[model samples]
Target: MIKFANYKKLYLIPKAQGLGLSKKLMETALSFAFEHYEQCYLETMHELKAACILYEKFGFTLLNEPLPATKAGKFNEEIVPLEDVNGETITSDEINQTESTIEDLATLKTIFKEDGTVTAGNASALSDGGSALILMSESYAKEHGYTILATVGQHAEIGCDPLYMGYAPFYAVESLLNKTGKTIQDIDLVEMTEAFSAQSIPVKKNLNIPDEKFNIYGGAIALGHPLGSTGSRLVTTLAHALKQEDKQTGIATACIGGGLGIALMIEKGVGL
Candidate 1:
C-alpha cells in the first residue's frame, strides 16, 4: 500500500535559522520524498506557525479534521475510565490538578544523580496497577471469525547503561529497526513512555522524531503511570491513535529500570 511521507522534524542550528534555511531543508526533504512516493504528508502543531506556513507554501494543505482509519463508520469515541495507582476513580479535576506547570516542575527535586532535568514533576509518577491482553494465534483468531484490530510486526529488547537507564528505548529502537530492516523514517506513529522529560526529550532530539508523531496526545507526563501496565497502556494508546490518525504502522517503546529497553512494532488490525 502507498503510505505517507517520512518528513516531520526539521531543524537548523540556532545561529543559522530564519535565513530561508528551514525552507531549504524542507525542499531537500520533499525532493527526496517525491522521488520515492507520489504524495507526501506531514503534521505540525499550532505553535509552529512559521513551519506550518512553510509547509503550506510548499502545497501542503491543512485538513480541518482528522481522517478516519477504518472502513467502519467513524473513529471510536469511547470514553475510557481512568483510575489512579490507589484504585480510586480519577476525575477530570484530578487529572487537571496533576498537570505540572513550569513553576511546579521547576520546584521538583532531581533524583537521578542530581541531574536537574530528572525532576519528580517531569518524570512519571509511581503508581500501583497492571494491564493484561489476550494474544491469540492468527490461525485461532481466523477460526473464531473474530475481527482483528491489529497485528504484531516486530519486537525487540535491549540493554543499556544502568545509570542512564532512560536511553534504553534508543537501543531498543535500534535493535527493532535492525530486525525489521526498516528505518525510523518508516514509522508513522510512536508511543514512547514519558519515563522522564530528561530521558524522553533527549532521545527524541537525537532521533529527530517530530513532536506531532511522537505523541500527539498527552502521555504519562499528563497521565500517571502504572508500573506493570505502562507498556500495555502505550500499546493500547498507539492502536487507537493509529486508527484515529487513519494511518498504519507505529512503534511503541519504553525505557525500563535496571538498564533494559523494550519496543514493539504494531499495525492497525484488520478482520480475517
Candidate 2:
C-alpha cells in the first residue's frame, strides 16, 4: 500500500508572506514527493484560502483527508523577469530590443491543436538575437592574464523517438551524468531549454531537479528562443548564472529538431 503524509503546521513568518516563499516551500515539498513517492498528500485548513489555492495550483485536488497524487502540469506559464547578475530587472530599452509581454491569463487564447492546453501565452516565442562566448585553455588564459569565468566540462548527445522529441533532454542528461560519474545532485544549476510546456514538465519530473536549482531566470518561453544561437545562448547564460550565483557546476541542455538532445557541463573557474 502506498502511504502519504500530512504536512501541517507549515507557516511562514509575517515578513515572509508576500515574497513568494510559500510557493517556493510548496514546490520544494512537492519535488520531494515526486522523487520518493508514487503519490503524495497534504491536509490544510480551509481558512487558509491562499494556501489552498496554492495547493490546487500545484495540482492537488481536495479530498477528505489525503489528496491523490497528481503531477504538476503547469510549466512555462511562470515567466520570470530577466534580471542581471545583481538581480536588477533588465529593461528592453537598455538592450535596444523590445521584450515580448505576456497577456493576462484570462484573455489569453489557445491556438494550434483543438482543445489543446498549449497556447500562445504558454509557448516559447520565436526570437531574434545573437550570443557569443570566447573559449580558451586555462593555461592559455592564465598566461594571457585573462580572467576565466568557467571551464567547459563533459558533453553528451542522444537520440530518441522523434514523435516524443521533447523528452530528448532526459535521455541526454542522464547519459551526461553517467559519463561524468556524477548524479543530478551534483549539479548546482541547470539550464534546460523550454521548447514547450509539454516536454519541459515531464523532463523536469523525471530528473527530479529541485525548484531552487532549476532555471532561476526566465526561460525560452519568456526570454525567447533564438534557434541558431540558442545553444550558445544557453551556455552563455549558464556560465554567467554560475558566476553570479557563486555556484560551482551547471549543465546546459536542449532538444534539437529530428529527435536529438544535447547536454554540456561547465565548472566555475578556480580562483576566479
Candidate 3:
C-alpha cells in the first residue's frame, strides 16, 4: 500500500458509469500508491457505490465516526454567509429546520416543490466542472520542478444520514483522525462545502473546531456548488492554498446526497 507522503496524488478521475474505465483507473491508482507511499488514498460518493466497493476490495475502508464537539465549534466560525439564486442571504439556522426531503434533490434543481425547503438557498448549487492533481516522491519532486503542495496525511469516508442526505462529513472527519491517530488540535483549517448548513453547522458544533479554521473562503452556497466535482476542487484548492500560506495540516471535506461523505487530511510535509 502506498501511503501519501513523498508520493502524491497525481490525478483523481471518475468515469461515466458502466464505461469500463473506473476499474482500470482504480488499478492504476492502487499500483501508484503501492509503489510510492504506505497506503493508496482517494474518496468518492455512494452515487458510485460500485466504485466505493471496488476500493474496499482493494483494502480501502469506509470512514465512520463522529467528531469531538470541541472541534466542531472551532470549524463553524469559518462558514461565511450564503446567498440564494435571488441574491438573498441564506442562513444556517434556516437550513437545519428546512423541510427539504431527499427526493427533492433527486431530479429538481433551482426550482423547489411548493413549500420546498430545497429552495435555491438550502440545496447544493449544481454546476459542471473537473480537476486534476499531480504528486511525486519527495525526491522526485525536488529533482523535478514540482513545487510541493501539502502532502496527503490521511483520508476517510462515511454514510451519516441516508434520508436528509447530509451529516456525513462529521463522521468522515472523525474516522480520518482516528485512522491517522490524530485529533483536531493538529488541524489548522477545514475546507468544506456548504451543500447545506445542516451538515456544515453540525460539523462545527460536533467537532468543536474553531470557526476561523473551517472556511477561509466562501462555500458552495455563495460561490455555487458543483456536485460530483466539489470534493476534487475542495481538495485541490486546499493543497494549493496551504502550500501558498505555509500552513501545517489542513482538512477538506464534502457531504454528498444519499448519506455519503468524504474527508481528506493533508500536511505541509508528507507524513508517516
Winner by TM-score: 2
Clashes of 1: 2
* lDDT (10s digit) by residue, model 1, range 64-99: 112222123222332345654456663231222322
TM-score order, best first, reads: 2, 1, 3
Model 1 regions lying over 4 Å from their true place: 1-93, 97-101, 107-117
List CA RMSD, all candidates: 17.8, 17.7, 15.5
Name the top lDDT candidate. 2
lDDT per residue, candidate 3, 166-260, as tens digits?
A: 55777888999899888988888788876544345546667877756766544555345543467767877676556545777899987665567
User: Could you tell me the C-alpha RMSD of candidate 2 in Å?
Assistant: 17.7
User: What is candidate 1's local distance difference test score?
Assistant: 0.56
Query: RMSD to the native, candidate 1?
Result: 17.8
TM-score of 3: 0.56
- C-alpha-based local distance difference test score of model 2: 0.58
Which model is ahead, 2 or 3, in terms of TM-score? 2
Question: Would you list the C-alpha lDDT of every candidate in the order shown?
Answer: 0.56, 0.58, 0.52
Clashing pairs in 1: 149-269, 150-269
